[model samples]
Target: MKKFAVIALTEGGAQTARCLQEQLATQGFKVEVILPQRLAREREIYYRKGDFNSTMHRLFREYNCVVCIMATGIVVRALTGVVVDKTVDPAVIVMDEKARHVISMLSGHVGGANEWTRLIARLMEAEPVITTATDTEKVQALDVLTKKVNGWYPNFKENTKKINRRLAEGKAVELFIEPYLEKYVEQFNGFTLIRDIESHRGGTPLVIVSDHTGFAKNADIIHVVPQLNVLGVGCRKDVPIAMMQTAFTEFCQQHQLLWQSIVKVASIDVKKHEAAIQYLAKTLNADLEFYTAKELQKVSQKYPESAFVLKTVGVGNVACAAADYASGEQNVTQRYANHEITMALSRLHEI
Candidate 1:
């Protein structure tokens, strides 16, 4: 479950914190209210108390989100030494004691502070202070879209800020949409759609919305990879986690696929307890789906027939059938095999 911490200082802050905590709890968040020792003890408020700086820092590290019901300056001071990269840091929001305005103080976009700010503001009947340039200027934010589509930004190291800034400045940006996403082209307001690569119009930042990762690299190119790929695996019992990681990485590299594009991992139901495959799925943060031998047998005809595999595991090809079934698509990559595992990749087409 996602955890949230609500920190309050004064009496008004405490009251507001309680109200916000109740609302968040209803939305399936594990929330806790942290107040000062004196106020908590005297008022018998059910909360954690003492060491404001330490408590806030701990919550920042452990929680998915943190709402500080106090002065913005106090929240800033407490977070002075705890702030980190926006991508990995928890979303931080600050609300005044009266709760008239909710400010998205840290990790606004990718970390979800902007969205949370609006939700909390609505609950408190407060105005949300969204100051992100792309949002205020009505430009779509690529990072936020990435989150919504289960997509990833591989070239985010240098171009994240640059792309958003250029969009906000009204500079033209071109996009190449894959066939699966063609129907949603109208959702993007400021991009010129490219029909093909051969036309090659130059001089603008390019955004490629596709499931493949084989695009040529350019300083201005941003790849928005949707998580519509699935991986199927058949591994020897007791293989180590390192070997699984190496094999998966090699499979992605060989196919020119992004590791983040794999949304799920699948295998024969018997292998569900295999630690190596389980570890790989956990590492990828992908869903692990298992198929019975009967289910695998049904799809085996669509893939390469492996007589030995069928005799041993009751399925013609574990990796191919598993991936094909999980993706609900017939298009799959050729089997990639290592010493202890056989893997296959499949792409999904969204209607």
Candidate 2:
């Protein structure tokens, strides 16, 4: 659930915040209202009159969304010191004490301020004030598009600005996405899809969606890497973390895969507590899945199996079997092994 912090200054604002909280709760949002000590009711956080700036700074870092029921000037001044790039900042919305209008103050697209503004407006029956050019023009922002497709930009700050600027101006934007990613973005409009990346001329703004490396070498191309690869690993009982990291890095380099494209790490259930596997998953910032030997055994026949592994772990294969089962697809690569680690790669059916 998304956590929301509602900041109210006066008695009227406090009443509006409570009503908004109750409405948002019906929609399954976890809402907390903050008020001054004199106006605070039960279950609300109260602060000293002079501590509003500090309270805003703390809530900005802690919550997914912050709704300030006060003057827009107060919110803009208070958040000036705490504001960061849209990628890391929380969605910010501002409303008057009477709730006449709810404004999407900052981080409208990537941080979801625009969506929240519309929801709050609907629940409160207030007018939503959104000034983002993409929303006004009914064009899809590149950042929002990547987010919807479960992708990440390799160069987010610079590339996003250029592509979104073209979109806001109603210029043509070309998308060169791999076939696997076509299904996810087929519903979105406002972009021409290029079937082949090599046929594109250099002058037009282009966005490429792929998991391959070296596609972002050109400065003009915006590359969104899809998180679709699943890695299955088997390691020695106590392999060093550094060695495991090095082995995984070299494996990706050898396979021409981008490490950022890996979405999950899979292993046998018995090795769930292994330090090296944990380190690899944490380093990749990917989901970790552990399958029981019985589950893995069902898919072990598809790959070459080791008699020693079957005797030790009750499964003929660990890496390939676990990856194939977890991904619900055949292993993309044959089993790769070094001195202490064995690994296999598979692709998720969707992003």
Q: Compare the candidates by lDDT and give the number of the best one.
A: 2
- For 219-311, candidate 2 gives per-residue lDDT tens digits of 667788888788999987988898898888888888888899889999999899899999999989999999999999999999999999999
Whole-model lDDT for model 1 versus the true structure?
A: 0.82
- Candidate 1 matches the true fold with a TM-score of 0.75
What would the per-residue lDDT of candidate 1 be over residues 3-93, giving only the tens digit for each residue? 8888888888888888898998888888888787756645443434547788888889988889999888988888998898988999999
Candidate 1 weakest lDDT stretch, 10 residues: 41-50
Clashing pairs in 2: none
Best by TM-score: 2
Q: Rate the local accuracy (lDDT) of all candidates.
A: 0.82, 0.88
The ten-residue window of minimal lDDT in model 2 covers: 181-190
Clash totals in order:
0, 0
In model 2, which regions exceed 4 Å deviation? 26-28, 97-100, 182-187, 214-216, 239-255, 272-279, 282-311, 314-317, 320-341, 345-351
